[model samples]
Target: MKYAPELKRSATIALWLILLTFPIMVIQVNTIENIVVWRWMNIAGVGTVAFVLSFLWQIYQHRKTESPLPVSAHLPAFQRLLADPKLYRPMLIFIAAFALVFPFTASHYQINIMSTALIYIMLGLGLNIEVGLAGLLDLGYVAFYAVGAYSYALLNYHFGLGFWTLLPAGALLAAFFGILVGFPVLRLRGDYLAIVTLAFAEILRLVLENWNALSFGPSGISNIPRPGLFGIELTLEQSAVYMYFLLIALCLLTIFVIYRLQHSRIGRAWVALREDELACQAMGIDKTRAKLTAFALGATWAGMAGVLFAAKTTFINPASFTFMESAMILAIVVLGGMGSIVGVIIAALAIILLPEYLRVLGDYRMLLFGAALIGMMVFRPRGLITPSSRTYVFQPSEHQERT
Candidate 1:
């Protein structure tokens, strides 16, 4: 009796969902054959799923309202597993071993996919610095990515620079562009900042598209050589293996550097700025320097990743650095959990690899993917893994205690 209202609401939700999806889910027309197929079972399925989901949602809301503990107390099972060093240390070791052996075991196609995922992990971590730590919204991060790719492509085409020479060159050039972006939007925040960054990316793309002589226009630069192994020529398969290992090393280096930065003074300043600009300014932290550094550091990773991307694909064009690329990278950071290294890595892999694996489902793959994203947002709005607060334990020296 007490649950009557809840049940009634769930029933109403179920019916509404069924009504909304009737045309799409319950009926399919064959254009070639002019035949209409009725899938009445889809109606029943929708109703059942909607009702159960709505009921569960109500129960969850009820418990949430009644609970006194903080949201962090209700950590997900995966997070709990990670929190236990006894379990996670072994898990990390096992993962590292598997990663080292994966290239040898997997097919070249699979290796390529994994390499792409690794690139996104780098991008996600870089953006984590800007959006997650510094609370800056950059919608045109791909601009720096494009800058790095073009830097390598153009310099190589004109001056015949090698990948080894261009790797650092691209990163430095991207960092320079990051500072350029930071300067213009020094005072902007929120949506305004997003708009400016997005505009910057679009402008760059447009220039590359129109500048036929400089960028080769829409035809794009091709036949770009792969990363050379100390002037030792290798077969295509061997090069793929070499590239995979290189990316792995770079990913490790990125993780180590960013982890250290996260605990440094500038990192703290970024976090403070993220929390409150006025308070951050009042605390004597240089807001301009913090913002610029965040942008510069974030773009550095993107630039490196861009060089890797160009070397791996052996092609370059403006179409490749669209707004969608930025959005997907941003999704990796946000969905993984802002300011969390492990979360970004996991989310990048899942976001990039999940769709490829889901191809078996054909047309329904994206539908299921969208549903999963919706469920994730509804349940874990904070992200798959929220950044844990830092805790410091205090200890007193024996002499101080005696005094």
Candidate 2:
């Protein structure tokens, strides 16, 4: 029978990690002497960490599988608290309070990083609509983000329009492009659709990069102005704080709108489409409308995020919205648990903060990160926050008896 599968999985992971990280961890560049050096000790340390984590994961999995009850059942108090909405409501409130007060306690560096994470959170929420809700694989969702950034940058530079005014303009323009891009791919599905969308993004990026006359080319458009609060220009720290709050508002708006849409009739239709296109068509749902709407709405949010990103950095460049960026956004969605808001937020924070915290590792940071991600996928394929919702059951007998 199958037993200790985790051990087999961990062994595979350890082997891969050694192969991937050996060269980086074992070899070092001694810039002072201009010579290449080998650090066997460092390699051993890195390998040990990877192997230990994998082995521990196996133990955790064994315990989890052996337990017949839910994972949270061991913590009776926590389970009871979660079961009671009244108790959890206060906890949620406390969490929100802490978030509101977080910047005050943290450094400017931390605040800035958090703001970046929030932007990705918005992007992840948008992409979730297509990949998670509608099951549309889009590898070039960053096109809309670039569109939004350029739209805002060009409009502001040419017309002297402020960021507040440019926000909706960017989203609308992105949504327009979304529809334009969505039309051609409506007939395509799966990998074909993904390829087409990806091509579309590359085309847009190339246009922006080469058309220096309009986009300022590879040099990028700089000196982009930041939004002010109450017509007052703030210091760098104040600006960072203001941007942080702005992101908070935008993130909440995204969450609320997506939450509403997820529970609405349109959401139900999208879910049907995702489950089985043939079955969805047989149920009388209009595939065209559902698909287009998903694209439009998802792109709209990405555009908004792009606008925020431009404003935050005060620069717009094609390099900022590359295929790597798209991959990162997709990774956040997948790692966060598709169709889960809280999961997306948590994943975004982890993706952003983990790298920052790993700065001490220097060149070895990404190696460890990739290994951790692999481990996460192996151990918790469903993601840290799995997609879950409450269900209501109706009893016809009870209704008749009551009547």
Candidate 3:
């Protein structure tokens, strides 16, 4: 499945150029009934949309001639994608560039976007561990996030603990809650499973709201401290930039850990359990341990993200950790392509960054975002970056293969 170098380069360049131009197309003009903004060039967003439509039309016109098979009129887009590594390589490069350049860009508004995007990326990774790798559908991921944030705030403000110390403790608390959630519905499956997970997440949220004496109830925690490296506080000039690097490092580390685990015995066990718990159990893989491990590990990431969130914003609220937040994180895992780290990262960025870019589009913004997501899902059901052989190859068994 190889493509010529010239075509590959062209594909990659075009894709990124479109992507890069996309964010700059529309700017928030004003907000009356709806948020509106100024456009960069002449009718910017509209022009961009027209260009994309024209491009798609050209590709469609080539259908039978350049694309294969009767059923493949629509398939060439994806096939061409898989055959060319160039299409997504620029994306990788762009992400790397952004990681290096964005923090240096002196705009508080832009920095806020970067921080939020990083937080969502962390959240997406957490969901990916549960749903993508272990095949567990978590509808209330934000519960763990809430737990982590509150844990740190309560522990630190009340007990006078430091950020470095409470960070791991936050994650551990989230994992403990994950285990609690996992245990109750250990026998549930499919819709039942989803319902239970949702229930668990809501239960936690409700508890936070009602229990005001200790948890601060609905008032939420304010003035949470920013974490400092050694004695160097991040509150100095360019604090966002400092936090940016820290987050990037943490995210990369998390990604590295996930990659290692995905290739390790525990990771394999998760996939096995995902595919068939009964069979996995018969093989003595211990379904209970594997399931709990998946829940715990996933929640740990959520907790860690909470710690970062508390530090950066220096404010906390129950609204931030709603079920909708969980849904958005799960959306990243699904929209990006499950079990594909690269894809998940893209999805996370898109979910967070796209809306900010479309602020100028105002009234039509959400409508357009929803349409684009639906359109992409319809076109690339497997996700923008489908799992390839090199990405995640299932472990084999000779007996099963023979059968």
- lDDT per residue, candidate 1, 1-403, as tens digits? 9788889999999999999999999999999999999999999999999999999999889888888667667787779889899999999999999999999999998999999999999999999999999999999999999999999988999999999999999999999999999998999989999999999999999999999988999889998889998889898888888999999999999999999999999999999999999999999999999999999999999999999999999999999999989988888888988899999999999988998899999998888888877777788788889788698888999989999
Comparison by lDDT, 2 against 3, better one: 2
Residue 149 CA error for candidate 3 (Å)?
A: 0.8
Q: Top model by lDDT, which number?
A: 1
Question: Every model's Cα RMSD, please?
Answer: 3.4, 4.3, 9.9
Distance from true location, Cα of 56 in model 2, Å? 3.8
157: Cα error in model 3, Å = 1.4
lDDT of 2 by residue, 1-403 (tens): 3546766777678778888988887888989999998887775676677777878867776777787677666434533675689998998899799879998999999999999999999999999999988999999999999999999899999999999999999999999999999999999989999999999999999999999899999999999999878898799999999999999999999999999999999998998898899999999999999999999999999999999999999988999989988888888898888888877887888887898899999997998889878867886688766666548797689769988
Candidates ranked by TM-score: 1, 2, 3
Candidate 2, residue 353: how far the Cα is off, in Å: 1.5
Prediction 2 TM-score vs. true:
0.86
For model 3, residues 1-403, the per-residue Cα lDDT tens digits are: 3335434544555556655765556556455668666565634445556555655645555563685676634444644555678875775687689779876765877887888888888888888889988899989889899888988888988898998899899999999999999998788886788778898888888888888887788889998988877786545446777787888988998899998988788988888888888899899898888889999999999999998898888888787878888888988999888887878888899998998899999998888888877877876788767665446568889988999
Select the stronger candidate by TM-score from 1 and 2: 1
State the lDDT at 64 in candidate 1: 81
Off by over 4 Å in 1: 1-8, 22-73, 393-403
